[model samples]
Target: PPRFTAQNHGNLKNEEEKEEEEDRRDILAHRGSLTVRRWYPVGTVLAGLYSVPPLNEVVAPPPGMATRLCFSVEYRHSCEQLMVSLLRLGNLPPRFHGNIMLVELRLLPDDRRPRQAKARRTGPDPEFCDCFVFQVSGVCVPQSTLSVCVLSVEQDGKRHAVGRVLFPLEGELGQAGRVLWRDLETEDDTQVPCSELGDVQISLMYSPCLQRLSVVVLRARGLQLLTDAGVCVQVSLRIHTQVVKIKRSFVAKCENDPYFDHRMTFKLHSQHLDEACLRFELQQPNNVHSGERPPALLGVLVLGPFMYARGPQLQHWMDMVNTPQEPVELWHGLGRAT
Candidate 1:
């Protein structure tokens, strides 16, 4: 029995419409003039398709910073000091078992002395809820950083570093009160040269008026291999065969998270913009270059325009183009040199 009701007629109509749309698309494809319809802008559509993070969103648990530490920082105006509260730690390694874990807090560069929390029984997860105060009476707190280190003490009273994280005093945490979770880098993460390349945080800005590009290398983790070595980030600008400029960050050694906080600028003309590309190489001492081979690079990252870059790299570059003169910060995972 053939039923011709309103619902049946509507279903048939939808099928016919879909078939017509497909036929139209096929015809357009054959003509090489196909343009897919989208509700959002091209950049938005591509970002969604690639699962890339929005430009404003902060990436959590950075590529190499697997271990995380939770804590809060507050500045006391009256006391003229900073108070750091130790909250809790997540993802404590299995090696911490049967040992006592402790959290240490201190200001970096100027203050080498560390204020440590009371050691607690080792467990998968532990909470300290401890408080430590650092007197910044005459010191410029804005220029300093708060370094957090998690250590495990053996029965023999030998202490070993479990993980470490560096929290800058400036930025969002500079205010009176703020709580944040930061990645704690471990030795094992960067000990061996494996498939997992480390991660680097950088900010890029391009000014059309000045015809210049600025790159700021903020911090990096999980770059060490074999042992703790002095690592410096080398930034180079190249357009095909011609090299525009080369710069390097000051070497940071023997730390979980090395903070470079260096900015390099290059004069980029409008005509060569499309072919220009920036290359980042994490270079280590001794392994600078193995004879005729290239530098023993810990990791490498590339950023360029649309034709040369893809995924998040391309998006980062496009964002700079779309909003000139504004800095765009992103966390890029380093990949082994091919």
Candidate 2:
């Protein structure tokens, strides 16, 4: 019998399963739609969420941020559940694992930190009319996103990410005080698109033996300057929550291709490399592109798991994190181009 609620409408079921469907439908009818208010004095009860300090510690969002995002969540979709055979030997009667699916939702507070909820097992297509508020204070709402994934539970208690939806959070969406019946998208689970604005060549080296990290700013090419005014390149590094700005060098008589032969090293432990990231940024005092767009960012390139990339990104991850001493020189495209 199909255990999920939103299954194939054409699929036929037995008498008992049909009776169960009627009962479930009656329950849903009794339950009304979910609504969240501007001020939830009792958020814990509305969301049905309770956690101890060790398990659900309230980790604040990053600094240099403004505005808090508040939103509600619910799911409506049909997914496949794998039932592992319990019988080890063929002699025993085959046993089918019960139909069970878990929903794990992630509300990213920032690029590096993600606020994930405890997995909720709600059969198939469990639409909780009693919605909960997901509040991430002090975050860039437009930049952040919400990810809900369906997982199949095997008899052995193993879970697999089968299908999911990635939805971006914007300020305007919350103005209505509710997000009603949004269809989840499953496009490789990436919400934002990464652009190849320009190219940058950087070298990375790590020594677990010495617990140190080093990077050399080779050069930048194919860059679009904001204005004819002189521009500068900011070479920097980010390790976990700590940010080390190596130097800000000015490029005089700036053109598209500017050569910045600079190098920086950080005293990093082998463990810190897990959260370490390298960045290349361009800046200018004035706007050059007339009537195109505001020149907030001339160009930016990021190297870390925080920024999503497809296909060769897997190879890029391996070369950047694993391959040491080789000094892999790869052409990195700018993520945000002005």
Candidate 3:
């Protein structure tokens, strides 16, 4: 053995300290750090936190409240505009605290401007012949949805959602000069429904040769943010009860409608494809007070195979798998993560 020197002893001590630090980091990483990637067994994916109910069922309104809304939607293809006219409301519920009611017209997937009719005191029925014009140039009206919400103003100057009608703009509904009456659906009075959280457009592609899956976040609309802080999109790839990968898009200014245009790719073996799932979350970082807490999850959209996904989510996944390397894109309504 060589003679021991002070420098040699110091080097050995530093090496030991480095090893200890790395060991500590590894231990902490297993505590659900988003930046770290790990693998889990296949069984975890089968019975995991990602298991959620299919979003195909319509929510029935509460009994004794058969509110209905009459509106006409006209799509001016030549002018690339959509004209919405609020004709009247019938079977309205009784108001509380001497509040008045109003109607809000919103065009989905694009255009965040909501036109509100003047609030007025009415009996069981009210009429508002208000017409609002929205430019729908970039939006695909046939694939979009229109939200007609009836609201009531409280004495405290707060507005509450009385009932809402989500009308799909497709087929005859998408044609110009079409008028219809639809029943308004109501959710729990205590909280806002997940359908009001917003909507997101996602694009997915998988390549078997390389065993890679790519996901792109195109845009989101009608998002309700708590603050003015910017928001980022977080994509989590969870398999076997473990989040294997987490990626985020660049922070963009908070807006009712924001465009992410971010793409994240993951390398996945075809054997485990059936067990893999993707989670899209809108994270609103608290920029004002850094280190105060982690980013808040505004809304979430989870997509997987038929085992957990259904409706449009299942169809989108099948389209991508059937046509490998070809991209499949679709719009999904965001819901509060269960």
Instruction: Name the top TM-score candidate.
Output: 3
Can you tell me which runs of candidate 1 are displaced by over 4 Å?
1-195, 287-295
lDDT of 2 by residue, 66-150 (tens): 2112224322112211111110101111121243444444444232332233323233222222233444443344565555544
Question: What does candidate 3's lDDT look like per residue over 226-275, in tens digits?
Answer: 88888889998988688999999999878978888888999988887778
Give the best candidate by lDDT: 3
TM-score per candidate, chains pooled: 0.41, 0.36, 0.43
TM-score of 2: 0.36
Candidate 3 CA-lDDT value: 0.73
lDDT of each: 0.71, 0.47, 0.73
Please identify model 2 stretches exceeding 4 Å from their true place. Answer: 1-196, 244-246, 250-252, 285-296, 306-314
lDDT of 3 at 266: 93
All models, RMSD in angstroms: 26.1, 22.8, 31.8
Q: Please give the TM-score that candidate 3 achieves against the real structure.
A: 0.43
**Candidate 1 backbone collisions, by pair:** none
Error of 3 at 168 (Å): 16
Per-prediction tally of clashes: 0, 0, 0
lDDT per residue for candidate 1 within 108-203, as digits (tens), equals 544535577854445755667788888885347776677786777788876666767767777644455555778776645544433366788778
